[model samples]
Target: MSYEADVCIVGAGPGGALLGYLLAKKGLSVILLEQNAELGKAFRGEHLNEEGEAVLKSHNLFEAIEAHGLLRMEKLEYFNNGQLFKTIVADPTVGHLGIHVPQAHLLKVILDKTHQFPHFTCMLNTKVTQLATDESGRYVGVVASKDGISIEIASQLIIGADGRYSTIRKQSHIDMAKRKHGFDLLWAKIPAPKGWEPAIKMALIGDKQLSLFAQTNGFIQIGWNIEQGSFSELRKQAFTPFIQQLTKAFPDLTEIVVQHIQSWRDFVLLDVFSSHCDSWGTEGLVLLGDAVHTMTPTGAFGLNSALKDADCLASLLSKETIAQFDVQVFQQMREPDINEVLTKQIEKEQTFAANFLETAS
Candidate 1:
């Protein structure tokens, strides 16, 4: 099968989906492709900061997503040895320090809005095999396989929002510099105890950071940091002793933890690293979100930055004709802010332990 669009987005992630919707709303033909057969098949980095909220609101999407389901963090509470020592309340005007949005809710709202445009197309269970390039070595389209059927999509602009491990970035020969944060994360979700407040709770456990985020749908998401590349060795240890630390930090979770997290199998390990590309695009192709500037799950900046990227890129594209598009301009406009966020994440990691000590003192 063959298709054509003004823009072909290679990932139906938050950034890509939002970009597709924005472009289509502006009257451009758009095709969004996702390898996953369904949305929200996996959830990661669902937290949205103020920047992301503003972006969604600017597009009049925040309320729609909120209607689906969301939880607002009321404050950041710091605990040491299971004792709450310091609390930072949310701003009165904003009413939230951060918001927990399930990827399922966010994507469904955006894609549903996108479907209102007759020129918008979403292709699920499709994987791009290769970039289609012309004799001049400029990307022109993509060749993909959709449920065992080969398909081709031609577009004037190709966008790679495929994620940190981006095939489009690799095929475009974009160079990315990767940085390994000192820790990886073990994530698990358990039922929230009745009367749990919507807040982010932090604790220091043997120099590692443990966090509990109150999530929508009556759940608490746990993020436990471990030394980089240490999960395998750690798993060999007695699960009871290791899991007991969680109860020590938040005794209130004892009942739920015992019920939900039985073994190491209950936790999902995420290898954490941040990356940045020297260039976001080449000729007819461009990259956004994790594809070009991957952020570690620190300060919950990754999702928001990607949302801002989509908003800015969509604005820029809306103002230009396909023949006049320039990816460099977009990079120039966004790189400074992105670099500042990256630097802050590193500094936050280094100071995290000290912050606990200072607060306890």
Candidate 2:
């Protein structure tokens, strides 16, 4: 099959979807493809910093998102050994602040809004298999597979918004900067028991044994950050003992775990920084989102950075000001934020690690 569009964005995640939404709003023909069979998966990145919120507002998505019953967590709380450790209030006068909202829900809101434009098309269950470029090594189009059929979509540009393990970035042979910390994270949620305030994002740490993050749905989005291979050892001890460990770490938090602990999961944290050739476009190809730079979520900046990318791309495409807007504008606009995002993430990871080591040990 063959199709033509002004912009073909791969991966219908936050970045691709939002950028597609903005570009299409400008009447630039855009086609979006996602490998997922459906939306609403448990996406890991979930916070929307105040900067991210402001960007959404500027793009006319803030109100719609807020209306979706997103959790308005007024403070970001970090526990040292529990005991109401510290709080980063949503007072912008001091700095930036964001709240907790499932990233998938946010994406749905943007996609729904972007759909209002006739130029926008989101192809679900579609996978971009190959990048087609001209003789000059310029990206020209993409070949994707949907169901039993192979479809080729040619556009003025191809944008990759896939996640951390980006197939597009790997396939393009672009150099990627990667850092791995042997530390990993285990995440889960438990129902909130009586007297649990479920209104704020609460983190409790204890004896270097467990960490908990409280969620809004009368439950806590709990994570147990441990040494890379240590989780398996801990899991072997059974959930009851595991919850006990959390209680031991923050004795005050014991009540919640004893009553509200429901379940949990483990994950390895990674920090990735990468970019395409100086030519984000050989002819018409580009990269966006984690496909470009997968930042370790520290200050809850992954979504914010992605929004920054989408906003810049939207601004460029919407204006179409430079006549020939290609790789240069893309790189120039993206570099600073990408760097800032990476630098900021690394710093946070380090800080979290140090704090954990100190408190837990």
**Which model scores highest in TM-score?**
1
In candidate 2, stretches whose alpha carbon ends up further than 4 angstroms from where it belongs are 78-82, 92-96, 198-211, 229-241, 250-282, 318-323, 353-361
TM-score of each: 0.98, 0.84
lDDT of 2 at 141: 82
lDDT of 1 by residue, 146-259 (tens): 998999999999999999899899988899999999999999999999999999999988999999999999999999999999999999999999999999999988989999
Q: Which pairs clash in the backbone of model 2?
A: 49-98, 50-97, 138-282, 138-283, 139-282, 139-283, 139-284, 192-218, 206-249, 208-360
Ten contiguous residues minimizing lDDT sum, candidate 1: 315-324
- Candidate 1 TM-score, C-alpha based: 0.98
After TM-score superposition, the amount by which residue 110's alpha carbon in candidate 1 deviates from its true location, in angstroms, is: 0.6
lDDT of every model, 2 decimals: 0.93, 0.68
lDDT of 2: 0.68
lDDT of 1 at 192: 97
